[model samples]
Target chain A: MTTDLVVVLDADGRALRGRAPKLASEQLTAIYDAMVRSRVLDEGASELGPDELSHYEPTHGREAIDVGATFALQDSDWIVPRKHQPAALLARGVLFEELANAWLGKIEDPTMGRQLPGHYSFRSANFLSTSSTAGSHLSHAVGAGIGARARGDDTVFLTFCDVQGTSSNDFHAGLNLAAVHKAPVVFVVEHAPWEASERETASATIAAKGAAYGIPGVRVDGHDVLAVYRACREAVDRARRGDGPTLVEACTWLTDGDTPAWRCEDPIKRFEQHLAHQKLWDAAIGQRHFDTATAELAEAIALARTAGDPDTESLFDDVFMNLSPQLREQRRELARTATTTTIQP
Target chain B: MTATETRPGVKVMTMIEAISDALRTEMKNDDRVVVFGEDVGPKGGVFGATAGLHEEFGETRCFDTPLSECGIVGAGVGMAVYGMRPVAEIQFLDFIYPAFDQIVSEAAKMRYRSGGEYTCPMVIRSPYGGGIRGGHYHSQSSEAYFCHTPGLKVVIPSTPADAKGLLISSIRDEDPVMFLEPKKIYRHGKGEVPLGEHTVPLGRARIARAGTDVTLLAYGAMVPVCEAAADAAAEQGRSVEVVDLRTLVPLDEQTIVESVKKTGRCVVVYEAPKTCGYGAELAAILAEKCIEYLEGPVVRVAGFDTPFPYTLEHLYMPDEKRVLAGIDKTFAW
Candidate 1:
């Protein structure tokens, strides 16, 4: 379940003597800020109305994998995040207001209230849309990698999935395609065994699945942001160099109480202790970041609430480049009978 | 960009060859166009529909994929949204089930789901319909599945010329198009195709034959069946106008309504099962729009509502006899 490749950071967040990936203090602080903001946003969303709460799934304990993997990529590279990994979009610079609008299905939402909450797609930011279906985006990552290579661009595609996603047929198909074509893709899986079953042990780690496709795989501690960052950065570098895909399994527990021993393994708590040991954290600094995140989310929620629902006409838009004659006729009929009241039929 | 070798005049080719020609021409015309599928590379595809593409376009532009339908389609969706006009071929329409999620949930919803911020301009070309005795696994007419999904353009060309033209247009389209190629006519159906730059815009139907008694509505493989039935009806002094619904989704409803209005009787024909088939939609449209013009109830000649059987393949499909029966019943009414 562990390997030499797992870059274990000490309790103080320092690498075992000069083994740390060289990240600037500001960059480390920014990563911490992103994690805090993501946590705050999720907490706020969890307390929303039942209509909104139904779509929001909290990525409470896995912010490190989301932030670290996303921050490792360049602006030109693509990130196909899982539905639970809104933190990846936050790390990629999606505006908090826009995310809130999308989450609330407001008129200003980029998706026009089509997708559910937490599913984000920012084309300008090179982040593909997330699908609710498990492991479906893996093939899309491979396709984007193929597209980059075809255009002679060195853009790597990074996608994240949970441990159970590795068992999906799409996961296998995507990895196999990447291997055969030598596509530049990095797959990051947040490994949690209990998500599959309580009786299921760590019998076969997700990292080993890469060998079937002749790609190298690594396992890292998901609790360590620097560890996840280093592993994902190396994979990204390899992909950029045309070395093909690398599957990195970030071993972390999805639940705070998955087991008594894992209760203390919260990624945010672990990183906070590391930052405090490195003389980079204090009660004031932590409070300032937490307070800023809370205020920003509150403002975003207020703004989202002010936005109107999508116009009835927008329902007919984006179905095609131009609506067909049949669609045009249908739209006319809908417009004629349109009402603000939801029909109970 | 290398220019596709153009012929001096019109060229006669089969539907499969016309499809291959369209792919080569589009790939040569636009660098963004990429074609890939199972056996499409060195093998030129199982039916030779993609013959010589790998050699002509090289492995990167044209290549083979693993035996995974979902991967093929999902990858195509990804490539498309990332700004590539990917043309993915599913070996057969029946095999497209594994990739149905990618088509319906991903490809079909990308643009609307992203609010037009992202568009998937991709073509999924799969051979459909049953006639070659390939049995259930290899033979199916599943165009209705895609036609039912919004944000997708479903096209099924009936002639070699229409195949070339509609495919060229589908490739150039800005939305995801499910180009269902009728495998029954892949080689059997031959016609004179335009030499170069021929494009048949989608959502348009072609009147294969002009008549006055009954309007015979068909598409894909059923076009030929309707044609033969029209000929048989002609022998009986019954004039049947045959309408080829080239693109089912954007459905040339105008043409269908006009044809039905001109010919007071209408008979729909298709190879899919009768219940909830595309014929049902056609019948409903006719009932709603052309009811007063109709001389009889909208009759349908279609496969029985059962699994495509091996021994009764002939009986399962709506052949010329069944189509004639539909025409006769309409005339009688």
Candidate 2:
């Protein structure tokens, strides 16, 4: 008797080592640059906390969201960045300044000072918006895929972190909708292990979890950008060709820089270590990329710090597009209330 | 907007046929119309409301779908938002809960969220209000579930004419509508449905019977029950007015409050269970908004608190006898 079981990266990131597939140096450089930028942006940005204070705790365990997904989707394709996907959003197209401003809780933040800090949105970028509600936004990504298929656009990329604990109805509902519609969405569930909490997934393999839904699941080494890119590309192309959605499990590790809030280990460093042995590029070039990113990020951080100064009065707008009579009166009262009050300063 | 008065005539047709006639006429008039759901296509729907649909229009217009309710509803939301006036028929309203997220959140909210950037101008028609004994899973009165959600227009018609007209109007309403057809009334109840294309705008109520002493606000299968109760009340020398709220959600509050004002006494009736049921909404609206107009407390006659019981369905449902008792309670008060 034969049993079918799919493996989700059974190999250890520690023991496993392989040479990258053939690619031009620039293409290789771009992928490495993307990973570096992802790390730098991920290092600087605060994903989940109070509106003004993201308190940048780097992403732990979910390196695939950036290194893999960046190469997974085409440059023009839109990506809806969930609250935790700072690395993914940075790789997708969000600038360091935008993430910083968003963290500072500036008026210019795409969330319009409404939702919390990590929930960024850009309507023009094809990416709709992100929310803290666990898997509720996936359907919109699925809808974007449906639109992509109709327009003959190549593919769309979507990312999520599955805690198994947040196995709320939204998670099942979102994925089931994608699977049933056979929408052109490639769901990358960063199989978050302990740190968010120490609980392991009920299943040993992501493939086993995905197989329950009759979707194909493949695990990629999250630290290896080339491996992640290759795996995501296959899933995305399948969706673009109308074959249907694929669930990719990119097994990753949280590193030293990772804080409990939003921690991801440096894929660039790991990839560089791997590439050094493979004789891909000089170690100095990789070091320069890191040096350049830190310097640029420091300036961007200062600009974000001073540029956005929001007071209590700034909170009044966007509650309702056109404030109702009742709301207008409330705003007036609040303004009067604030004016009569004094500051300790 | 024109009153194409349709005289009453006895027409023996299945409830499914009346629904088919409604959908067929609407599809014929509008080119943007499309229909799809589980077992809906080549199957003409499990009951055949879409029987001639696939034949009349191409498979592209009417088709079968995967057994995914969320997928079906979400896709319908997408199609409705884009431009196509999609008529998504959930094989049964009982199965619609799986897709409740899209129905209540996305479809109902597209217009408001987009600040009118888009609208889910579509119709979600399903067999609802289980008088046919579809068992616990198959039989349920779920209009109250959709009515509670805003940005969704809910319509449940009791007669053939209102069924056809309200359905047509719901299809074109520039809003998402949950159009529930009383499964039991399809063949058992009959009246004249106008021959040509017609539409009954949403947010309008019809007076089924005019009486002075009391008002009976009812809808769906309960309309006939209220009518029967009015007759029984007449036997007791009690004059009762019957108002059929054809569209329940935008809920012609004026008609309800106006009728209550004239009658002085009112009993809100429905077949859905008593807890958080649509009748409660009606009763509360009357009590707070139309309190001064009422001569007595508004009584609600509805299904029991239990899940729709199969054995005692008669007892589980609100009938003429129970409705009259409710009216009696109001009068006594």
Candidate 3:
């Protein structure tokens, strides 16, 4: 018998755990500090900065970051994060420097800074680069998993998104390929409570949709890292053992800040308070972690302010690796004639 | 004279066989090379160009794909992006549309969008053009579609030697290339193709036959048609220079304009529809840049504006008669 759907919620909607973890923590201080830093990064990042990526909207729902799903995989496993959220990458050992560098389109960043802030990729980590269009990256992750399995290596691949991003042929094609090929790919689809303006009806759950394609779908409280870690561990174990693909709906909430134009849920503040109440961390340790995050972020901001903006030469240089003879001549002409161009603050 | 045996210094084999020999040679030369497509594995291609390929290379390198064109192309994109020199076959030109998304979206944009970080130096092979009784679906000339797309190198071979030599060169190129094999001329046109090793440079147009009166710019199956047209025009006391544009996207405009300036009259020929065809593009360029050198109106010998008709396909096709007529009209002007 299979469970239709599973929901793991903590009191105060903060520490929801859908699937519990099989792995034990070696660093309580480090994990707590990392979560504190993640929360600071979230709080510090201005969601209202600018509509830089105004072209494509989240297909069916407001973008919801799956909090607990990123930490459940092994060290060698690949994670294809399909959103701007850093919760998963944070767990996967992606540094804030690298994420920010990639976001700023720096050359040293993996994927050569070809991606936007949300779509992250790492060559060394084996993370498949994300595409701007919703479903293209999903299929690629599936292909990478297949390639890994073919080599007799059992490294599981993970991609986390929701039904909002799946309102495209890309999703259907990628998932279909994974299902038909029995690739060792586990999908974490975080369903939003609302679909842009429309509240999500029962029809939008990816579990029902994924079941139609022969991929086993599991729903868990996305808020609880332990619950997500536990479920994902099982899926990863099953995948490593050649059980084929799995789809997980980690039921999460958007808690940053809710607005008329968009919705947000403050997941971090609530979770930390729960940890304190349960004596998971002493009040002093928790306060210091938050204070350390604040100081480090302040230093990053100061360094960014002093580092200065990149010049216009980057525009032409970044376009090609080796410029053609004609393009070389054209660049010489641009140097001789075109006026200096600068970026505004 | 037998086509396969060299006439003292020349050997002639079918175009498809030359392609097979080239692929075979290239694979042996490089260890990282792989070939794939629908029906291209153990059974070879539908045209037998990849015949005996799987037997020699094993199914790992040379393999058949599921009937999904998009998957075939997308998988090639992935593999190429992963640093393998992959040669993906689209089976037929008409069916290559399903992979156009992969071509234009992922393959073409990878280098540019990555700011030169990642590139897919992959080659897509498909049999294109009409002359055989393939009618609308299979026989349609689709080179113009790829020609209009930027960041893609498009190559078409008119002879057996070129078919093999160019395929080898395209595989080694550091850019995405659409290698269109004229299906009608695959076995129909035979010539001596160097067997040992050879490479043809891309973005260069060859003056197939040179003369003075008019310049005939053409490619693919139409190279033969233009040769016949030039021969027919020569009988009328009019000499013609034929320029075979092997690669169309990054066109050899300099070569074309130079040939046109010398001839003082020009005619462009292709098998695709007359409107928005490669011929029209050439016409516009000549009119704008080489207008003073042209002694006559640039005439076009191409397929009709309508969809390729089934029964009237032969008539709709730009044949020797139509090409000759077009040349004659341009000479008169």
Report the candidate with higher DockQ, 1 versus 2. 1
Residue B54: error of model 3 in Å? 3.5
Cα lDDT listed for each candidate:
0.86, 0.68, 0.69
TM-score of 1: 0.95
lDDT for position A220 in model 2: 61
Predicted structure with the largest TM-score when compared to the true one: 1
Model 1 per-residue lDDT tens digits across residues A1-345: 344447647655666666678888888788888898888988888778977545777777788888988888888888887786778887877778988998888888888988888788777678787788878899999998898789888999999888667778899899999899889999998876347633433445677778878999888878788889999999999999999999998877423233423534667777777778777888899999999989988999898888899977788889998988877887778766877623221
DockQ of each: 0.82, 0.12, 0.31
**How close is chain B to the truth by TM-score, in each candidate?**
0.97, 0.94, 0.96
RMSD of 1: 3.2
Please state what fraction of the native interface contacts candidate 1 reproduces.
Answer: 0.81
Instruction: Provide C-alpha RMSD values for all models, in order.
Output: 3.2, 6.9, 5.4
The count of backbone overlaps in candidate 2 is: 8
- The best-first sequence of candidates by DockQ reads 1, 3, 2
